[model samples]
Structure formats: structure tokens, C-alpha cells
Target: KSQEFLPPDEALEDPAQIAPGDWTLEQRRPWTGYAPPYAPDLNALETQVARFRRGDSLLVVGAFEPQEEEQPETDTRRQSMNPRIVDVRSRRNESRGERQARSNPFGRIQEEPVPFLPEEPEKTAPVQSGLFLIDTETGTHHEVLGEGPRGAFQLLVPNGRYIIGVEAFSPDDKRAWRDRHGLWQDPLVLGLAAVSDLLILKGGGNLPESLDEALPTAMPVTRIRTGESFKAAWELYGLRIGESASVRIGVDRGGEGFIRRLGQFLRVLEPDAPVVMTYEDTGPDVLGTVFRAVELNLPDLEPGEYTLTVEIELSGREPMVIARPIVIVP
Candidate 1:
């Protein structure tokens, strides 16, 4: 009982003529790649299904169920068949990606435009305080400086550089408040300074007239210390009619031989005007009262309002004139 043997390679190559024991290569194509031999038009079939109104006969080709009972419309029977429904499909957002690509020409993601913020402005420099000037000729260099209220600076030249002096503009070293209250301290050391476009002054060195040219544009600087010196610490002293009131008006630095020289009386004004109060020219008056502290005693003055103005001249500076009024009824 010997069987006829077949070779393996020939059996695999020619599987159609081989027995059932041969392994055949199964080559299958997808259903979507091929079409049915006789398929119905889907669009025409949908149209025919939608035209089924009231009564329409559907011809079942093979093993198809036929329903003679028609679907109900507006039925109010005991068993209400209309069930509540909600659509969860994202049909509205389906074309969002296509719309974004159309607006962005460079294939960039469409984004909201950002707002711009403005930058801060720059600040301006402050105006200068005072101008400085200096002069030199034939090796004789002299510095002439003038300072006071802004209008009182034109007495100085404004075109050159001068060694600026620092000074304090407060009088009454005690910080008292008054109109004539400002003093210039020791000369400050500002090595070498420069000024430009200053005004040229005219006439003599009277501060008011000399500084009138640079009136509105000049800055105030301290040059001279002019104020009331605390004469005797201001103790409440009274002057009786015939008691010979002795008042000191000069600054004597703690009696350390620092005596501010008082040469002659500047002027004598009754109510501000220079009034003539005649006394013996050489010696004291009949009452032993000499004009020392710009002082005078009234032997007989009717008793009313009297203003005493005394002008005292400083050595190498301007004369100081002080005027104060007193009301006498008795």
C-alpha cells in the first residue's frame, strides 16, 4: 500500500492542481476597493423612501419584511410615543480649523491683537541759581561778586567765571521771622565757576539801580548779612523819663576785644525822614547824654506818636538805618 509522493516546492507553486494537503497563498482585496455587480443608486433610493406619503407599496425583492400599517402623525392615544431627545454632535465646530487657516495667510495661528503701552517722557534740568564772574589784568586779579534778591545781581558781570562764594540767607541766627531777615555767612569755596549771557549794569553800585537790567530773570543769592543783633538778650527794660536809660547797640564778642567799630551816627530820622536833632557839637548835651548807640532822650515832646530812626554806618559796608515808632499818651 505505498502512496505516490509529491515534492513540497512544486506543491506550493502549483496549488490549484494539488491535493487538499497543499498550502495555497490567499490574496484578498478589500470590499471598498470593488463594487457590487448590480447596486441600486443610493440618491434615487433615498428619494423613493422620502416620497412614501399616506400609502405606498414597497416591493420587497428577497426575504424583506412588508409593513402595511402606516406610521402615525399627531396621535393622542393612551400610549404617547413621542420621546424627548437632545443632539450631542459637535456639528457647529466642525469647520473651525478651515476658517482659521483662511484668515491667517502665513499659516500662523490666529490670535487676538495685543495693546501697546506708551513710554514715559523725559524730565528737564533745573534753572541755575546765580552767575559767576572773575577779572584779571596786569597780574592784578580781583574778584567782584554781588548777590541779593534776583533783581539785585546785575551789579555783577554775567559773561565770565568767578570763584563762587557760598552763604546762608537767614538772618537773626536765631531763626526769627521778619521782613529784613537774611544774612550771608562766611565766603563759600567754589573753586572756579563760569557764567554766560549775563546783563551789563549801568550807573553807580546802588543795588536797586545797578541790578534793574536783569530784573525778572536773575536768581537770588546771599551776599551780606543784615539783621538785628541781639543787643543785651532783649531783657524787658523800661526807660523812665529822667532815669538816663543806657542801651547798647553794638556787638561785642563776649568782651574778647572783638568790638565792632562805630565811628559816627549815620542819620537821625524822626519818623523815617532825616530830621535835625541839634546838640552841642563837641561835648554831651546839658543832660550828659551823648549820641553813642544812635540814642537820644526827649526832655519834652508833647506826648503823642513819635518814631525814632537812627542810621549807623558800618566801616567798609553800607549804612544801616533802623526806624521804630512809639505811642506816648502820658
Candidate 2:
């Protein structure tokens, strides 16, 4: 499971677990406004497998090193490939067949070709290729012939994380994609890892922005340049036209917090502070919901991944926060 293989702090129970990273692959949770176009098909699935094989596309998920109690991925292949394996779906089908045979006077049961189901899985026997969603909590899975879970944390995942199980269809992958649509059921195999730290995703600006601004250009702000100036626009709610609110746009280094006290003692160090924009909202209510657009000038920063957070707080209410992960490059 991701919790077991990923770093210890990435676990849900771990207080150090930070925000979810960019999980924009395979439309698991596309924020695009598609009146819902496209359905899972042999072609798309196969193409994805090939992409992962050739290292063209990337998938994002979680995993941590082993904790005290759990041994992640130990003898998993041997367990899944064991010659003897029984499953609930197959047993249910067999039970239904027996009932039908008992109803017939001659007691003859004819074998029927099983229909491919999107969610109702059959048996878990190893195959050359397949796609599955492994529910870590339940230790059960259903075939992903259609829609799958969309989100990083998958908070909807009961008691555990969700692991994507993608078996490669190599050596004529296209044909194999179509051939192994519903046969493979064992999800105890397959994988990928977080490459955000290694690669910068430049083409992810199409997703809807948290701040509602009628943009003049389509800039890929997901990749921010260190020490460059940029502008941000956002709408604030619950504040009257003349009411005061505090607005701030800041970059976070996550758990790698700086030792400010030590830096403060050294004037030469300048007490390392993040690039922050603070706004004094003295009832700056523009159009109904308080709106403000400010040009932000970023300070020199080390090239790495950081979270750009935009927060607005009214005097007596909870502050509305929206953030995006940005990869700072040289």
C-alpha cells in the first residue's frame, strides 16, 4: 500500500503528512467542465499503458517505507500467483447455476459465457494485462472498465488509501489492450511513483483557477520562475464594500520550515522569509463579493517545489483558502 511504501510522514495518521501533490494524470479527477465526455475504451487504456512503459506519461500516487507492523509488497507476486485461489464472485455465479440446475427436471446446467462487467469483478487469476482499483482498506478490488476514483487523498476511500493497479500489455500493446479488457482480475500487481520532484509539468494551466479572474493570457503558472514578478487576482466573499479583511499570498516550504530565530540573530542572513503579499482591506468592496487583483513580485527562491497559498480573512469569519503547487525553476 502507498502508506506502507511511501515516506512515514506521508501517512494519514502521521501529523507530518502534508498537502496532496499534483495528481493530474489520467483524468482521475479532471476539474475540466466536460458535460462528461469520453468513456473508458480499449484504445485509451492501451495507450496509457504504452505511455507508462515508454516513460512518456507520469502517474501520481502515494507510498512510504515500511513501518513497524506492515511489510509492504513482500512476496506479493508469489501470493497472487499461487495455484489455488478462490473468490466470491465466481462462487456466487456457481451458486446461481446450481439453483437453476435444481429447478430443471433433467438437472442439466448449460455453461454460459460470462458477460464483462465494469464493477462486478469475476475471479482473481493472473493474466497478461488488466486495470484495477485496489481498495487498501477493504483489501478488495473491482475491474476498472469504466470510471474510476478521482482525487489524490481519495478521502472517500474507507479506512485506507486507493492504489491504482495497471498491468502492462506489452509486445503489441494495442492489440493486447483490446484483448484483455475483462479477463485479468487480480489487482495484487502493477505500479508507478511520484515524479513531480524530478519533472516539471508545464502544460497544466488548462484546469480552472481557484481565483476567478478574466485572464488576459493563458500562462502556465504551475511552473514559476524564482525571483520573477507575477500578478494574482481573486474574489473574496462575506466582506462588505467598506469592511476590512486581511489578504495574503504566500509560498510555503511545507515541513521544511526555516529556523527563523537563528537567522534573526544574524543580520547578514536577513531572516529568511517566504515571498508574501499582504493586503489591508479597509472595506475595499469592489463588486458585491470583495474582489482585488494585485501584481506580485517574487523574491529569490531555491529551485524546488513549493505551495502558493492565497488566503483572505474577514474579521469575524473563517478565512477562505485556495492553493496551487508550483515548481520553481532557475
Candidate 3:
């Protein structure tokens, strides 16, 4: 029972041993020491069980980009029996470790000095860019974040049901998706946000194109200096000519104010003196969008967080309200 470390080329449990755990100490050499697993090759597969580390709520995904200049030829070729049925192991992956350097005649060279790691990831064509988590149920795209310079991207997301897919690509391939001005080169995204159910952008993403008329501009107003007046334009659909409605637009506490107001509508809560603007469909007889823009010139107030609340009440239908958070600074 006074056995110690055994040398290589000898099994710990020899077939001819007289008894279990009864190896003679003379059989083991004095200088032999423990030997760890040879050149550890760690492999991993993303599974549903592995992804949800945050108590069943998958918060985010951390993705890795491949080496840009990987030469698949240099990798030691591997041969295995081809199974009739293909599975996870048969899928192709060109990603690899550092490039092979010249046999260092002067002993083992440090990995830092040689041109080992590739400049960018995914050598072939740049793979894909941008990280998005689409909700599996509703298909709502959440936390669309761009990659950083060093080929890593991240997004902190709220708890939700999602099918996680995270990947990245090389740097030279940036021009294909982005135009010369570095803007996303997709013309279909031009549709107004309201018309597209927040798909494209409401107007165009700037100031309302028409100031006085019923026109919503792409101009988005999120922050404004105190003592300055900001205006917004909105569009409403399905209205007959001469149909009248009331609109109330004002500032309230920011953040959760939208949810609070929304709940109020469910429970039928109405304030006594809301800043209401009367809107009457004066367009043609056909049902079309009624566009209108508003300018606010309120007296000075303390600078802080607020939500621009817009409530529209039709003749008989339930009121429709939308609130956007804004910040005021001195």
C-alpha cells in the first residue's frame, strides 16, 4: 500500500498484477512523476441547457470570431470512419489556433514574436456582422448591437423567450452592407416607422418634414436643452372625413410613465385638465392617414426625466396613447 507515482509506458492497473492496489514499490521507478492528459483539446457545444445560466432567463450570448488567415492545409489531417447518418460532429468548421511557424531551430520560440494569430476572424469571406436576439415567439428583434474594433460584440438583454444565434465576421467585408457614407445600405428601411409598425422608422428619423401641416418627420427628439421648444409630428389611420377626435400631448415623469399610463387606460383613468388638441379629419372622403404635428412652448421647469405622452380619443373607440421617454437638461 506504500505505492507511489508510476512512469510512462506502464499502465497503473497492469493485467498481470497479483492483486488490486497491491503493486510492489520496486516495480515503480524512483524518478517517475505524474503525467497529465496529453495536449488537452477542449471542445464545447452550445445546448439549451448550457445557454440558460441565469435561472432559465437567457440574458445574453458571447460569440467568438474565427482567425482571419487560417490555412487549413497546415492542420494535421484527421481520418475517421464516415457514419451513414450525419450528426453534430460531421459539420464543417475551419476555425483553428495560431498559424504554424518555422521549426524554431533555436529551441521553442515564444508565441508572441511570430506572426501567429490572424489579423481578423473568419478567413474565407467575412461571415456576418451585428448581434441580434430575435424572440422565438413574437419575432421581435432585441438589442441590435454592432461589433467593436477587435472583432468582439455584446448585448445585455432583458429576460425573454429567445432562440440564441450569435456570430461575427472579418473587417474588410464591412463595405458590402454599408454604403460609402457608412450608413446601412438598405432602401426598404425607408418606410415610415408608424406606417411599418415601428419596422423602418416613424418618419425618416429627423425633424418633422412639414412643421405646420399634418406631417411626421424622421427627426427624433430625445434630449433638448431647457428654454427651448421641441415639436413632434404624428399620423393616424382609418378616419372618415369630418370625423372628430381629441389629442392630449404633455410631459410626465419618464421611464415607467408609459406603462403606468397604459395601465390607466385599461382601468379607465382620465385626468381632469389634460392638454388636449382637437383634430378633425379634413382630408378626402376615403379612409387615409390624418397627419398632424405639434409645437410645445411650455414655461421653464426643472430639468430632469420626462415622457412625451400623446393620447388620441376617437368618437366611440377606445383611446390610443403612446409615450416616449425624453430628458431635459439645463
Between candidates 1 and 2, name the one with more favorable TM-score: 2
lDDT of 3 by residue, 121-164 (tens): 53454333343455544666554434322232334444544433
Off by over 4 Å in 1: 1-296
Model 3 stretches astray by more than 4 angstroms = 1-135, 138-221, 257-284
RMSD of each: 52.4, 17.6, 21.9
Q: Of the pair 1 and 2, which is ahead by lDDT? A: 2
**TM-score of model 1 (CA atoms):** 0.16
Give the C-alpha miss distance for residue 19 in model 3, angstroms. Answer: 67
lDDT score of model 2? Answer: 0.33
Note the residue pairs that clash in candidate 1. Answer: 166-188
Better of 1 and 3 by TM-score: 3
Taken over the whole model, the C-alpha lDDT of each candidate is 0.21, 0.33, 0.35
Error of 2 at 327 (Å): 1.4
Cα lDDT tens digits, model 1, 1-330, are: 001122235434332222211221111211112111111100000000000001111110000111122222322331123232112123366464554344222233323321111123324221111211122112222221222211222222222222222111111111110011011112212331111111111222223321122232122211111221111001111112232322222111111011112211233332333342432223223432122222233434444444333333323334344332322244
